[model samples]
Target chain A: MSQADLSIPFRRRAGRAMEDAFLQEALTIATTKFIGLRREAFDAFPEGEGLRDRAREIKEATLQHLDRYLEQLIGNVERFGGRVHFATTAAEARAVILEIGRRAGARMAVKSKSMATEEIHLNEALEEAGIVPVETDLGEYIIQLAHERPSHIIAPAIHKTKGQIADLFGKELKRTVPADPEALTQLARGELREKFLQADLGITGANFAVADTGTVVLVTNEGNGRMVTSLPRVHVAVMGVEKVVPSMSDLMVFLAILAKSATGQKLSVYTTLVQGPRRAGELEGPEEFHLVLLDNGRVDQLAGPLREALYCLRCGACLNVCPVYRQIGGHAYGHTYPGPIGILLTAMLNGPASVKELAHASSLCGACADACPVRIDIPRMLIELRRQVDEKRIAPWIERVVFESFGWLLARPLLYGLAGRIARVLQRPFVRDGAIRSLPLFGDWTRTRDLPAVASRTFRERWNELERETPR
Target chain B: MTTRAEFMARIRAELGKTRGLPPATPARRPARPRVEAEAIRAELAERWPEALERFRHELEKVGGVFYRVATLAEVVPVVAGIARERAARRLVSWHAAELGGDLGPALTAQGLEPVAMPPGEVASAAERQRLRELVAAAELGLTGVDLAIAETGTLVLSSGAGRPRSTSLLPPYHIALFDRTALVESLAQAGVFLELWHADGAPGPRGAVISFITGPSRTADIELTLTRGVHGPKEVHAIFVEAPIRG
Candidate 1:
């Protein structure tokens, strides 16, 4: 789905999510459970706080010298007999992978869970080129079969129920299946196993690439990351330039906190580090290895407002703790990425104009920052994005005019007092009890919430009366 | 397409526009990683018993089975028992050179068909294909562990001659053998070994890949319901040997 097709607007998408009874229950249960699990995991690990700081520092240090690290990484990859490609945009990334697929004579490609691939719409491009792209991750596979996109970063199919998943499997596999996760998983295992062995190309996203050693790391629970990199004849790892870390020691700091933040596990089931193509003495591995380093607006963020977001691990912890995200699920954001970090990422990729409505999705709650393993000051960046939206004139005219004029009036005390008096008279007609239930020109804001009525007598007026009555 | 030169130039341009954000540096790596790693090994040589107990405890917490035996010969009975209980017939394993001993004959006597991978690369593509199919069909996969982390119950395996990555990945059940030499207390210590492995060119050719296996392959994607063995082993069994296999 293209951004243009989301013509329904953010309000309608969020409203539809709010009205979904199943989604409401699912979000509450899933996010609540994740919050508990993460708290418990951290409570047990004594060094978690220090590790988070170190991880954040590693990200900052790497970005500071990214040029040097990436060059070293490229040289080492070439030394290990692997090829590297540079992509400045999503379209260029897709083109590079498609060209690799064509040259390898690949008819089928199997993919593990990859948000980068999703961002670039690589599956659609592969299909258009007559090569079948199969999603091997269970969550990704379910969404792919259902012709949908991921609704969560880690738990992609949290919006679906067991019965809904069974139906999806039944329709795709052409058989009746039970509504049991165990049974459904076994069935998928059998089906995807065939694709794993038969597919000529395997694609994955790097969790972290060790710059000094030229290793592409993939952290997964289902081991599809291993299968994709091992079984296919050609392996392609798509990664943002920011995924690179300085050294092996720095990689370990992230390993300590990544899975704990994501799923409360001490570590994920698999963290596979692939250096290059198959070695001379190895029995089974991809003969050809390609690393596609994608810029995709991430480079621009070095000095841009969203520079801090480059430290995101995509752990999905912030989403579970976010009040707005908890109310409205990922799809309501209408982008490849979702949740607090997703809003920043969307602006980084599609520009600030794309996130005009999304910028205000947060209540400036600091819960996301506390929940983040890397401690990204998400609320700070979100406020900056909102300012950018209004400054760029991407926000609605009414919102801009109201906030801008409010700022203008606040700078002058006389005008502010006069405006307060004017609001008191104007609000009398719409005030019900203590709050304004509705208003003219901006009724949309008060439709779902009540705005407090301006006090009958302004504070200045009360103070002036006090001065006349008291000599002190 | 963006050239490497062009991409770096763009990054440098953006970086030049920034000023004093904060003073930060990456985690400090050991100056002589090889020496540091050796020191860790020397310390572990005395504390392996405690580390092994922690490893077993953590492994069991993640739904894995852990066993400690007196010798390499004792591992066969455990493997046979696991196979017997599961009614498994075919087993794929690393070659004797990588595993430290050949258990093919003993495993066959236990009524299991065993196929150990070639010590070096297969001569023919057809042979490689046949081995892959065999691994995919096998019910059990056995290999050796390079490092067993006590804090997280992770088994680190490097892919190289004789030891294919699939021996720990392909089948429904995976069994790994480790000893005191491979035991580590934390992921930080594992990092030291990792740095040492890639340090000064003094050793043989390193493998192209290293995997850290924490538990069986799992997923909770379907409505947050956890299920195991989605694409990798459903069960992971770690057998700790009291007597070193190499010795």
Candidate 2:
């Protein structure tokens, strides 16, 4: 779908996704496998639980004094001859990176998989400026060819079958290859290797930045992080302000648990720690280094209702466990981020008005909170967002009216009892097999689910009868 | 465009709005990193055999081949045998100083064409480009491990003079040689060594990058089917030298 597809109502978009049989089957298999792997990985390591709590505390501590750590980060990066730029918005971030590319005389840029770049839509901006942005990560490369957004955080192309991927590659390379993962991967390696060696600029997102050592850490299984940071003449890393940690000691605590939560590995294949541009005596590295600290709606949440969201590691563990996401997948969320945490993040990056429909997407089952490595209370914040939506009058008039009248009745016992008695009579015609299968005014809700019929006898009536019969 | 002052000021204002948050602190850094690192070294001196055993188990679990050689001299025969089995030639290795011994002549005597990287940076862009081509075309990459983490079967290599990052990347086969000195029991112990490197006035890594490689490069992106060597080495071989090469 193009950007115009976003104009469709979120409900309709989600409904369409539900109709896609391939997507449904793929989502079930992928998420189920990820959940099992994460469980097995954590089960083997007894220290994982304590490490998770420690990681959570470290995130909070760093955020509480974000200013000091950021300043230290800036100082250390500069001390090592790297330039730092501050971008308050996505547009500014794009402009800053474009300027860097222009200054470096870059013709083609190679990139590793980065949600920050996806959030800013950097590839389009780079293209407009006449710099070809090549995504080197295999999964991201497939999506870029298919002209689609990532459907999963760690595995971007899971929505695609090997046949579909082989077809996509055939379209790109103008030649047919066998529909096999190994063949497709080798072909991509060969194709992207030439780009890596020839690209003038390399772009990436930092998994975490060490404030004390001025190091930007990138975790990947494909080794593209190393290739991008090493082979190009100029390197640029864009990161959210929340990615900064205090020291290398703090960084190790996160590394211990990051891959386990994301891919169920003890550690990712490659954890590259880059301090700055090429240092003296280095044969191959970028001549210029730029670190862009992006604040695009993140700074507001430092004290806003979504403050805890800044603690997210972007592991996608919550997405796997979320019942809604498992059914609809990522693109149905109709934004850069998707899933339960994606709702809060979308609200953080956009606004509460942006997630008016998305706020109600969750079942509030608390499975997401349990699966979260940092133990973020996602359901609690989701309820807060729902309340915000209702208070702002963003919900439809019918919903507001129903909920408002329900609240009024709940506050008054006499009216509540009388209304229940009236509902029992009114519900008799619709009630069948003890369930109201359809309702005239609530067709949207009743179409997919059945509402329980009102009881034949009111609870208050039964309670009074019991009280009268009791000897006491 | 946002100035640093404006950006930081906005953050400061938001931070001020928070009140009565729970008390929290970051992980406690070692007070004296160098001393702590030495202490770890002293403790490992007696427990290295156990650490090495764990390293072998974890390494094999991740599909890596493990070999133990009594001395650095024996590394050549193992390398030759691996190359012979795979019918691979044209190997690239770190400079003799970085590898702790010169094996170029011995490897050449075994009928393999080995190229050692220059000890320092090549001044010209064209020369650097030529060197990169050689590394990229070589079938095997040979280098020394700075830290071999046993708990996770990870090899940590720092890029510097004679130790280019691509020595272990951009090749089909990667063979890393390490000694007892480079072994660490866990990531926490490696943390102490990392802290010691970046501590005040300490001589940290000579280059700007440190890579922790657990196994061969892999991806399960296509239908969740595991495939190795997408953009890095397909096979990783770690040879442990029972005698310290640095000595």
Q: Which stretches of candidate 1 lie over 4 Å from their true place?
A: A1-5, A456-472, B201-205
- Per-residue lDDT tens digits for candidate 2, residues B1-247, read 8998998999999999999888899999999998998898898899999999999998888779999999999999999999999999899999999999999999999989999999997899789889999999999999999999999999999999998989999889999999999999999999988998899833357799999999999999999999999998999999999999974
The per-residue C-alpha lDDT of model 2 at residue A100 equals 98
Q: Residue A219 of model 1: what lDDT?
A: 96
Tell me how candidate 2 scores on lDDT. Answer: 0.93
CA lDDT, every prediction?
Answer: 0.92, 0.93
lDDT of 2 by residue, A1-472 (tens): 3222778888888888888899899999999999999999999999999999999999999999999999999989888989999999999999999999999999999999999999999999999999999999999999999889898888888889999999999999999888999999999999999999999999999999999989999999999999999999999999999999999899999999988888899999999999899888888899999999999999999989999999999999999999999988999898888899999999999999999999999999999999898899999999999999999999988889999999999999999989998998889889989999999988888888899988887778899999999998
Check candidate 2 and list the clashing pairs. none
What is the Å distance of residue A157 in model 1 from its true position? 1.1
TM for every model, in the order presented, reads 0.97, 0.98
